[model samples]
Target: MQDSNLFDDSQLIFRVLVNDRLEYSLWPTVAGLPAGWAESFGPASYEACASWLERHWQHLRPSGLLAKGGGRG
Candidate 1:
């Protein structure tokens, strides 16, 4: 994907958003990210989000998992 068109409105833009539970989800840039979620990596394509999740979501469990603590803990 060309960097110039990454933000173009025609393509499906994706944002790697995380919720309070620290669960990660692929959010469409066309929609507003849910209230409590924050952008981890953003304004990318579906492939980008998928690739990122594959690389970084080593532990599928939410970070808020009591066994793991929360917020990057």
Candidate 2:
């Protein structure tokens, strides 16, 4: 039998990644972290990561953008 790919397996563990702009994303633990992004939470289930992000990342705008006078004229 072929082994399941960790990236493709929702049941596998995941992590919540945050970039310098404070953007959050769900990343599979098997994948290498991209440049300018770091793990903020998890090594937990996908649902858990999603829940954490939902609770923490309430703002959709990047922090830098918000700092620039709410990115408005």
Q: Residue by residue across 2-34, what tens digits does model 2's lDDT show?
A: 997766678878999999898888999888998
- Candidate 1 lDDT, tens digit per residue, 1-73? 6565433443688999888776888878878777999999877888888799889878766755756564343
lDDT of 1 at 54: 88
Among these predicted structures, which one has the highest TM-score?
2
lDDT of each: 0.76, 0.87
Q: After superposing candidate 1, which stretches have Cα over 4 Å from the reference?
A: 1-11, 66-73
Error of 2 at 44 (Å): 0.1
Candidate 1's TM-score reads 0.69
Candidate 1, residue 25: how far the Cα is off, in Å: 0.5
